[model samples]
Target: MSSRPRRPAASSSGVHLLSSTRVITALVSAAQLGEDDLVIDFGAGPGTITAPLARTGSRVLAVERDARFVADLRRRFDDRPRVRVVHDDLRTVRLPRRAFAVVASIPFAVTTPLLRRLLTPGASGFSRAELVVEWGLAKRLTAARPRDLESAWWSCRFVLTVRRRVPAECFTPAPRVDAAHLAVRRRSEVDRRTSSILWAVLSAAYARPSAPARVSLQGVAPRRITHRLLGGLPAAEVPAAVWLALAQTLAADRNVIPPRGMP
Candidate 1:
């Protein structure tokens, strides 16, 4: 069996400084964090956002991989009961089993995979996430509600919103591009196997809107994939919901899946 991932050495490019007091205040207010909340500050660098988060009366776990930042965080929150320093790579740490919120000015490099860990089907105890990420990525994610070809398959599992745009100047290092506050709220649960099939089918279909929607299921009779299951709609016109419903219906019977062709 494969062991869990190990903590990684901190990357220089991954470290951008988010130390503006004004921005921090605005983010904390927007998140509505309080004493009752448990928040994970992923990529917590030098205790910038983490310090303010700790002040919000919320229980804060600051995850940092750099030894320098981890040492600083430990010293900064040494006497505080509610603030804990996790000197490990955020990607390697599994979120606590108890329900928690995420408020992080995350490293730009790890945004996608970290989101997968938080938003994938069947994950538990995830209440919400307020993230500061690249503007382009956030725009793509929220371009269409749960329908954008890339995010659509996972969209039903969470309510993701791009709240506002943040300027590059907000960070000390000043990233070449702008960033945004992306909020994600967990919604109702769907069957894990069904969710997997949905992505699998879409993964195969990665079809251009103009192309015919093709789903190649091996061994299963083509007759089983009738117009009814396909929503009687052309491939390009099919909504994410339709794809999900179709995959769910198909997944209930067997281990059938898409042929795996998407990039």
Candidate 2:
């Protein structure tokens, strides 16, 4: 008879395993997944979130970077065909080509990069996500006005909101601070063209974030139009909605051309 593989040592990769079943259930339930949905559980350490996610009847991609957890995950879900244990870095894992939802308690260390991959403009087939991220990051993402260009750009394409707080005690090796349930959904109303335009305009405006919106947006639209749309507000103070309006207006103008290299 063949012997089973020995369990590997604990990871030092900044992953805190989810120890609270109630928290796990709540997080998975919030995803509202069905069999039709395809979900990716980033940082699926020991199948904590992955198990409940599978119970939802959705196809689950349990992505883990550590070899130990990967082995454990594969063994735990071997009987469950719907759960595919992927032993790969979440940072580089291939996202689904079809529309998909994400229900995972991702690692705090790679929160920004993971979000960038999923929420960046033109990321194909990404439908929506409910992620467990650092509390500070959650607040920044859902802020009334994004603090930086990247955050603003993401806001132009998606609606980011905080669902609830996940206390630190919920994890086995509790983190220093609490986590938050950050919900991300694409802006169905905004089309590809509008998103492209927002990217161009916002990129220009944020280049000189302290400048008056009219001056910052002069390259994209006529000064008169920018002045009308933005008034005297600084580029930093301009919200995503106003930026969208500007992009939409620019998109409607036949005379105006998008900046070279714009998608």
Candidate 3:
């Protein structure tokens, strides 16, 4: 219940209080958290979702990048022991090595990077954590569009549930298009290390086979490797050890085609 209006909803930019609070409520209910759980609310604008999340008796960390919003939150919930307001950008902020749930209101920008870091290897990914995020499904990404999300295929187990229509009037500065909520959870146990390892191996395979070349500053960046780019893997990069591990990972789905021919 912090009554603060932040941005506009895509449906109609009428400046209503951030109604996206409901999305947070849905996420909490779905997670069925316990007292020992830690719930993170990234991009917490003015503690709307943060305050409610704290009521669940779980330790809540509300992360906001804006300085003004941070000061306001500190003043609003200073006495709440269950809540801690962090004034830092989530992209660079080092999240706790463990948490029960991670949720966000889905700012239009940075969704891809957020997913990449959360799904990436090491301690950064949401190991054994439930993740809930909201996104705009109405916008279609074309190569002509500045940013293309077509290459990003959601995990098979992930599910998208559309909520009530959110009007543009919901925010201060309305976005150009309408938005929808996407609730995503990994149905199976996934090894974060394996995911990262696959990313590295598959990316190297997709690069065009050209060699005996000097170290070029214009070399392809490490992040370009995606599921779409896995088909054209280089033969030299496919070692036995890496392939064996990949085979085990892909064995669960027999239809999977290895980036490299089976040795």
lDDT of 2 by residue, 1-263 (tens): 11122222345876676677776777788788999999999988877788778878899999988898888788788888899999898889888889988888888888888888888746578888888889998998887677778888888788888988989987767889999988888988777666777788888888888888788777577888888889988877888788877888877876766554443
Best by TM-score: 2
Q: Which one is best on lDDT?
A: 2
Model 1 per-residue lDDT tens digits across residues 1-263: 11111222334755777766666667777789879899999988777677778778999998988898788678767888888898888888978999899988888889988887787645578888888999998887765433345577556556778888889987877789999988887655555665566666665554444454543332332445735665334444566566666676777767565333322
lDDT of each model, Cα atoms only? 0.71, 0.80, 0.49
**Every candidate's CA RMSD:** 7.7, 3.7, 9.5
What's the ranking of the predictions by lDDT, best on top? 2, 1, 3
Of the two candidates 1 and 3, the one with more favorable TM-score, higher being better, is 1
Clashes of each: 0, 0, 15
As for model 3, its CA RMSD to the true structure in angstroms is 9.5
Pick out the ten consecutive residues of candidate 2 with the lowest summed lDDT.
Answer: 1-10
Q: What TM-score should be assigned to candidate 1?
A: 0.73
Off by over 4 Å in 3: 1-17, 122-167, 192-263
Model 3, residue 45: distance off in Å is: 1.1
Each prediction's TM-score versus the true structure: 0.73, 0.91, 0.60
